[model samples]
Each structure stands twice: as structure tokens, then as C-alpha cells.
Target: MLEDHRMSDISVAVLCREAGVSRTYYYHHFQSYADIIYQENIMSVVQYMRQLPDQGIITTTTMFTRYFELAAQSRDTQLTLVKVGLESSLIHSFESAFEYLVKNDLVVKAHPSRIGKKYWTEFLAGAVVNMAVRWLQTGMGETPAQMGRFVSNFVGLTE
Candidate 1:
């Protein structure tokens, strides 16, 4: 699996053989390795986020803590994602996911600033995803709880 090898070192043949599936089956389910990775990680997070209570106060700290906790649970997958040069794709996925939350009113507005809702959500998503990428790049020295607090504080996203 990915635990023992770099993503670049694993080809479709190796993956299909290990999973006991044909190349056709693999192609039927996924476009590529990156697609599998994206679905398994980012999509799971998005699905979790979608289930969050849309009617609550949902503190920024709570939101981020849950986010980072989920990310931490998938630490290896995330690191591999960055290692495979999919950081931009990861960012795009998170941004799009965040936009979905906004459109669905799953999250409260951080502030009533001059910024438009769409741009404001983009700004927030960009900041959070950038922090996550940096955290992964620098070895994730901080715990998920710590990261949650740090990001919330840094963004002035207090309660």
C-alpha cells in the first residue's frame, strides 16, 4: 500500500494487482490514482462537513478542531497527497467544498465585512487550506487541537 511506497513508485498495474481487480475495474471506478486519493480523503471530509448541524452556533474553534482532527486521522494520506504534487488539487477541493457549505448555509458568516459572501468564503477556505498545507509540509508539529486553536485565533474567527 501507500504506507510502504511512494505514490510515484506505484503504478496502476501494481495497484490493480494488489487490490485483486482488473485494470478495467479500476478504470471503471477511478480516473487515476489521484482521483482515488481525492475521493477517499477530501470527499470523506466533505461528507462529514455536510452532516454538521446547520442550525447551531458552531464555533469556529469547534469547526476547525473537527476539521483538523479528521485531517490528522488521515495524516499519511494527506502527506502522500502533498508528496504527489497534488497540493493545488487539494486546495481546489477544499475551496469547492467550503463553497458548498456556504451555498447550503451550513456555516455561519465569520463577519459582516464589505467582502461579498462568495469571496469571503473563498478567503476563509484559502487561509485554512494554506495553513493545513504548511502544517503538513513542516511535519505537522502541532496536534490537531493545537492547530484548530491556532488557525481560529490567527484568523480572528473567535466564537
Candidate 2:
């Protein structure tokens, strides 16, 4: 429903009707419309990240590319989310997911100081999310691979 209508314009009734679900069911599962949208965005990123191999500079590039690809595919929804102040929730979701990778030792050979690691994790996640949002806002003039390389290089992810 978010893809079909602006976030500001969508109501619970309209969404429930369009989704063919009862308002009770929707309310039972989602706290609000923003929650549903946030969960959807987070799940999409999580699913893509799960398909990637363990973390490394190359893997980071792949992750960014996949994120951009998803954003490009769901440009309208992303734009609406941004417009409705839900972009931070989406970014926080990504940040938490990336932090999980780091905490689980999936990030091979990343030996930064504890404080540095925390800062870098937040920085990288924010960069990727902001860049993806910008790309979508600008009509995604660059291909995913192109933006991927640009991000990788910008972050000095190359060996």
C-alpha cells in the first residue's frame, strides 16, 4: 500500500482494504503504519545481507550494491519512508544488523580500537543508508555497481 500511495495519504482502513486483511489483524501485528513499513524495510535489508559472504572490503561493496539495488527497486516506498521521518528507523535497523556482523566475528581482520569500531560501524551504516536515499531521490542516475564502487572507494574499502 505504501508503494501505491504516499505515506501521508495512506490510512489504516485503506491499507487494510488494499491488503485484504482485517484491521484487527493488521493492528494485532503492527503497532502502527510506520512500524509495518519499518519492518518491511529492515527485513529486505536483512535478507539481502544474509546472502552475502562474511565481511571484508569486497563484501562491504557487495552489501552496498545490494542495498542500492533494493532501494532502486522500491524507490517510491523509500521516498515515502524518508518523507515520513522513518528513514532513521531504517538506518538504525541496518546499523544493528552490521553491528551483529561485527560482534559475531564475521568481520574478518577488522582490528580497530573498541571506540573506533563503534564509530566506524555507525559511520559506514549511516553512509550506506544516506547514499542509497540520495541515489533514490536523484532518480538513481548511477547503476548499483557504479554507486557501489563509489562508496567502496570513498570509504577506502579497497585493499
lDDT of each: 0.71, 0.74
Residues 7-67, model 1: lDDT tens digits: 7799999999998999999889998887876676667677658645566556667677767
Let me know the TM-score candidate 1 reaches against the reference structure. Answer: 0.73
TM-score of 2: 0.76
Q: Candidate 1: list runs displaced more than 4 Å.
A: 1-9, 50-57, 112-123, 136-143
RMSDs, each prediction?
3.2, 3.2
- lDDT at residue 78 of model 1 (Cα atoms): 69
What value of lDDT does candidate 2 attain over all alpha carbons?
Answer: 0.74
- Show model 2 residue runs off by greater than 4 Å: 1-10, 53-58, 107-111, 114-116
**How many clashes in candidate 1?**
0
Provide the lowest-lDDT 10-residue window in model 2.
107-116
Model 2, span 1-159: residue lDDT tens: 554566778888988998899999998999987678678867876776766665443355676677677778778877877876778876877787777766665543323453245478778878888998998888788999889778877887642
